[model samples]
Target chain A: MMDKIIRDNYQRETKIIDAVYPRTYRDSTIVHSDRLQCVYDVFTYTGDRLNDEGVKMNLMFLHGSGMNRFIWDYYVAHLLDYKLGAAINKIVTLDQVTHGDSSVLNRGKLGVGYDWSDGARDACKVAQKEFYSGLEDNSDDIINIVVGHSMGGFQAMCCGVLLPSLFDFIVTIEPVAYSPNVPNNSNVTVLPPKFFKAIASKVEDEFKNEAEYDKFMHERSFFTKTHPEIFERFKETERINMEDGSIRTKMERRQEMLCYMTLHPTSYWLLDGAKHIKVPVVSLVGGIATWAPKENQQVLQKSIPNYTVDVVPQGDHLMNIEMPDEMLKRLSVHFTKFAKEYQSKNYDNSNKSVARREEIFEEIYKETERNRVKNGKPVLAKL
Target chain B: MMDKIIRDNYQRETKIIDAVYPRTYRDSTIVHSDRLQCVYDVFTYTGDRLNDEGVKMNLMFLHGSGMNRFIWDYYVAHLLDYKLGAAINKIVTLDQVTHGDSSVLNRGKLGVGYDWSDGARDACKVAQKEFYSGLEDNSDDIINIVVGHSMGGFQAMCCGVLLPSLFDFIVTIEPVAYSPNVPNNSNVTVLPPKFFKAIASKVEDEFKNEAEYDKFMHERSFFTKTHPEIFERFKETERINMEDGSIRTKMERRQEMLCYMTLHPTSYWLLDGAKHIKVPVVSLVGGIATWAPKENQQVLQKSIPNYTVDVVPQGDHLMNIEMPDEMLKRLSVHFTKFAKEYQSKNYDNSNKSVARREEIFEEIYKETERNRVKNGKPVLAKL
Candidate 1:
């Protein structure tokens, strides 16, 4: 049934947006020249959509590091199955800056040391533009949910904290929400910045062809268990062709290394920012810990009062990629349950949600006004 | 001559400032309650002071972690010698937040994960209030020089970047301006967060009396070569006399650990922020590498075009604490050379410096006005 849905109607519109956020150092030194060009794909439901009374969801999917928006194509196709399709509105998945098409746009401007919060802000900007643009509120009717994997999972968590009123529910698959305070697995020695550089420097950048790249990836343990079709999808989405008929990874190795260095600050932010998250979050951890330890996962569960931890017995850090079927099953069950519960539950803050939306919109309008005034541009309205 | 000056003429007045800057996480989540209470001592020249024709100067001293402003007392006392005292007007030594008196004042409000940039800002606020407050510019007459050790040294470099027109020169003693891109000592494995926490947790926080601390510190290699008088000063400034007759360190173990975790970001910031620093910076590194590798020190020299590195033989990371005489000698020579050069050399941007000062003041005023408006206070000025 899922295959038929994907084959028949998996149409998507690609979005290219100029994200005006300037890159900044840890000391808040804003680099105005470094801008992120965000690229996302919106998969709108072509079939009969849900009515006004039914639960309508604008699902935002964020891919992990070294991945692009197209990674979610297979998963989005599965979401379109009749079991979850009735409530589907649109599925939006984005390529993080320095990944996929966005990397091509931000090539020379990419700065050293990526901050996960910036990634969160990037995601929020796109989400706000897509779902909450106007002054009129649409909170009680349409729900916005974020589904992310690995690094993206952590960004999803950040989204919940940055704008508490934006997201309805968050699903994180093996998120890197580690805290140094917690006791981690003894066997796994965390990589230092030096090691990160070494690893990135050693990565093979150029390949002869797609077939050659496939052969190389097949040898790696992480890719061995990945679904063959998904592996093919990765080859398509994760690499770009050169003029000389060679191919290279869309995400630069330097950018990937910066992402690794960013893991430290991300852990710190997660520990401190966890207390501010008011939305319900469901984290899927693997039985065998890979990057974030099992103990850290437990701490993460305890950190957020509304967070739940679900351990997949045979899965590891790359569970979503390696065991897509298992992840899809869990996701389907969760969506169905959440959708049903969401519709029946008495939300006392339904009115507050509308008011909060207006407040957010007003805040955005005021900021725009400030920028307009700063640039000496003509102002449309007074703040 | 140094001994005569120390015994007869050294006098200092202590000042406590309420640093209005709030504690913020890497994600920019500002914790307003966690404010820094800065404590500094202003040492006035009781002897014949330098006139406006001569080089009038304000030298600011900053100590390292597990230390206080008093660590510079011995060094400050020496600076009043006839060789350097003729040109010296005043010396100000400050205790960083979470150290000495400042730590006692900030006991309950210290947040986890310290950012070195905040430390720099704290120093800047104090320097600005003490030296650069009035609308009239004093850039030409009273040259501001910052002398910092270890963590404080890095913050000194940061001050140069934050307000380019504030300081004329910076002297850093074994600053932790490390970069992962540089080749570091292979023997030193960068301590992971778990190790930092473990180390902090294992630190001796309580002692029976001053004698016990002396005995404990005497056995440590870093303190073995420290002057006995300075060692006594350490006991006086580094620990707090508790109500229960027990002595505890002023800087909390948790805060110390946060300081360690911050080294990573400090390294990243120094690498990025070095280029923006227009002032001449002299970094006095130890011959034996301690926390930061010699290679990283060299990289620091390379990163800042005007930066110079001087290695002190027989000195380690605690060179300033262990061998104050050597550091003082270098400082005196540099100050004498700079003072003479500054008087003769024509600065074409003397007018620009005044303009820059006004620009900074206006920025501060606008920010304060915005905050006042946010808090519903009466507006005092226009942008």
Candidate 2:
């Protein structure tokens, strides 16, 4: 009955995202433009497709870790049916490589190992082909907007910063930054890495069928608190039949562990990206999320130029899911204004504005450090 | 029959450590040298009491978070029976101020909501009275050594660093440092802070008797892996029957959460202490603990003048519990050597030795940074 309810929601065709990018595993030679296929769903506006205006605006949504493009399917349906009437031309959602129906070229060699940089490069490849390549002489007239959550958020920010000309407008929600300045409420205890390896070991590679998998999932809550329908949609979208005549998850456990261990360390990449990015950013924060909240955004915004924030009041870390209406309401205003100004060629995409914003962020950091001293709080150490 | 089996081991009196120290708490005025009592168990040496050479080496064991001094009781029993063999004079194990039978001076205000710095201060106060003040003016002749695990390990490092005059020798096992430079492999996912609060709220503060609590605990694992007798000893020593009607855990749940939150953020205090500390430090690593291992110790030692490490093979983060014999074996060698040298007045306690050690540490950091750059690994951000 549950599977029927979920399957009924996603009856549309799932398109594969074909792209090739360079990849490297630990202690091995790097592979350049290695073939990769990710899956995505695109939503076109009801009436805006044939709009008389020459300027265009489209959104590309990126999902976080342990989740696929199915996360945005609910938002797309809700947005089209009720929100954003005819404000946008198109909306694109893609599963990250190794997630959902995604596959890589060197199957065995690239098994379950990929870095955040790889994810960023892959997203860039997909965006370049789908959004930019076929553009006519009016390339500057288009705004390839990007929205991402968690891991995707980190990757999206990287895309916006690293390849500035590719992605125009960016919105990153609760991007993970492990810097000391970021207020993380996660467990600080040294739980053994083997504990996760053990958890992975416990997962059986083969299940009799979807029914057995469903029954097993019914006994356990995936996350602490989440809507039942969302989890059901996940199982519907991500679970698949294996070639060995059994049902199993699309992504492997060993790969997930590798992803965590390899990329979990914090150094200076995110901050470096933020330091040089030419565009403005809107960082969304879950109001009550102590783990990764507005405070972390404040740290990012202080360092990054023109990085503003929107907080969903009373929302948890799953802000996009828990408070979709609030998220859309906050985002639509910015989208409408951006589209209107860009359409009229009135928006300034100049270096002067970027310079001014940099000064503003500098001043903010200085003020924060001053007040921290005045209030007897410890001043955050910078790199 | 089960109770008989459990209680058969810990059949000694649990002594209360009485001392007075200044304290401040939430929503209360500062109080000076407030009288407090901490629980402890002292184990004297075998056969050899007074050494022929008139040398002395005393041991004080400090337990980790959510644990009483009963942890060292196992080591003491094992060491006295076999390992130490009268090389040391006395071994005393004390509960941290907010744990075990310790009574806070400001009872209502400090109900388990103290910071790590407070833990350090309280520990110093206990050491001053119990170890130092009890002795005659031969302070330089006698070695006041301390061994601690987890939070206690951190505090022991702090004691060795901050109050270098008091604490002569220190062995810190798996100390927690939340700095960016300190590589930690714990989960970086944002879990709700309320989860711990909710867990605390569910705790039945008042239990009918020891049997009920014992039955309750039987369902849970104390540490990752521990000997049955050690856990059983914890129940006997830390669990107590309250006068009015019920039995309860010595440490409150709220206190545990506060300790985690207030002290979790990274700062310059430990680094500042490390820069100017006078005593030698030995940091023990569970060879397999990726969370905070030798790499992190290298960072700490770079700033500290005299810091070395001992790695326990095939051990987890809980070094004291998992490899008690190895921990003691490594420590006993150092203790015996230090005692003999001190007796002969031949141990190097010169400024030149400290200076030379600092240079060695500086070279290690430089070499590590050079190798990191050479291998294309990101250099860890310095505070």
Candidate 3:
């Protein structure tokens, strides 16, 4: 059902860009010292323009461990239509150094250790060189927003800290920015080794048959409660059949583990950088008591003084998919407010014309109204 | 940071129960009926267990039009942990009628007007009944909670209204339960229809190719922005290759319209039913300012006199997934308070041996400590 909705509601174009270096190794020299070569996949809405500017918010999504940028596809669709017939900006998703279609590290070697900071640096390099380049050219006219979820959220924070001048705003959903030496006594931890071993064994057994692995992961992963249409759609895109009729995740498992093991200690770089960030920062925390400890929120609020945290009620780690509407709402408010403030501050008294601004607003209103009628909701229309 | 942590710590178990029906509709009998059938799929941590005598929360996930139950897998995984760790009673998920493995209405006939109330009725008969039966059998020992998102959320409200006795609590994330009728004289009505057609046409063009269609939906759907992981997963599960080499959604498109257009009018059956509900209700409204009109929340709160409406700051319709941890926190506070009150009233006076209860508490404490250690955190040598 969701597929048809997407078909009936959204249009996207995905293009894979080749990275300069095909692989990253612990000892490998940087191919481009100033930039990291990586694949950029942009999902643009070929629908009616939501704004008079015909501009969209460009999100450079960063994937979590063992995953790729593809994780965000589901959420982007629902956001296409705002509750009041408002449309959101476009999204550009990318794979981190060793995940997804991007170049593998150590020539595809499994479990090679990589510095967590380097990954952040690489992400910033991508944003500045690839994502921001376009935005920079249109900085005066575009309303750009940066959105990241989970690890992607972390990367987004890194980007905000590193390139604060480039983005109009930053939004992180359940960002994992744990500081080292923080008290862990009351924190939730992983189960025993035996439990993990059991899980590993099960995974291995399933790996012997790709389809079984797919089924196993499908059932076991945190997606069991998802709507079936979504679940089925995800399974189709995320699972790849192996030669033996078993399905293996497109992402390598060991690399996934490496990403998991790597952690960024509360770095002075991020902390110092965040202090200087000029744009509004909205952090969304899921209320899954287990995933996010109360202390974490306290620590974050304390660490990033300028940050505004919104705790999503009844949300978990995967809050974006579980609650896209909520996430978007928060984002919309922040973006709208930011855009308004930005325009006000940057407005030039001599160059600005009240009549011109009103004219523009009128045009946008007409366009929005037209969209509502064509979409079949002539009632409750927004302009 | 969360991505790495999840990679290191996350493990899940998924199960699918077949032959679940959301609701049944007999064209000759009634325009909208109150029974639905659905498959009940559950996901949980392998070692996690719920409190033996607490209220259990059942999440009845309803997919949007053309979607199935798979969209909620991620939510289930996260909510399952709540049920296990927080002493939640149980979690139940099902495919809506005409979707997933459930029997389709009209045997794949198109353009069936599936009233939203009918969908709600289906939930009442199938999922809600089973949940009530479980709670009723354990009424002296357990409580019941309901969580729903998007269309599923609307069904949750219907269930709350129709079967007020079944749930002790209800949470709806960005539920489009009612949209105020716009005045015809409003300027919004004057917009050109071509604009709406353009938006609709763009959506239609997404289905030109199978892979593109899948990608289009995966990228634009609500899940895309919030729960990217599950979004990817759903895209994989619910798409089929078409004869024209385009991917056709496995779900019937007309069913999607039915889910939206078939909403039950806020009639006496529903409005009066709300007045009779005995449990606390929490409606998590997304503050996107676009999707959910302020009037909708007002109407819901007015209808359910005992309800508590919380506006998720900067949240969209799918607030649950967008900010899972935050949502969890809000829900936990409510549930925990309810649980504590219930326990104090009912179990406080029971003359169970203090020594026995103490021993049980100690055992639980020890288990929790063990779990902390297993998760790779430093543990005090002596608890």
> In TM-score terms, which candidate is top?
1
lDDT of each: 0.65, 0.55, 0.50
lDDT string, candidate 3, B207-294, tens digits: 6676566666656544556566655656666666668777655555434433433433322234434543446677777777456567
| Backbone clashes in model 2 | 3
Model 2 Cα displacement at A100 (Å)?
A: 1.4
Residue ranges of candidate 2 with Cα displaced over 4 Å:
A1-20, A24-35, A42-54, A81-87, A104-107, A111-113, A133-139, A179-212, A215-229, A242-246, A264-267, A293-295, A341-383, B1-383
Ranked by DockQ, top first = 3, 1, 2
TM-score of each: 0.46, 0.41, 0.41
The deviation in Å at residue A226 for candidate 1 is 1.4
Off by over 4 Å in 1: A1-7, A26-32, A49-53, A133-139, A179-203, A346-383, B1-383
Candidate 1 clashing pairs?
Answer: none
lDDT for position A142 in model 2: 59
* Candidate 2 chain A, run of 10 with poorest lDDT: A25-34
Q: Please give me the DockQ of candidate 3 compared with the native complex.
A: 0.06
lDDT of 2 at A233: 77
Per-residue lDDT tens digits of candidate 2, residues A94-202? 8777666673222332333355655765676566556643445434455778888877888787775435545667888777654232112221112233444454443
Cα miss at B51, model 1 (Å)?
29
TM-score of chain B of each: 0.80, 0.71, 0.68
lDDT of 3: 0.50
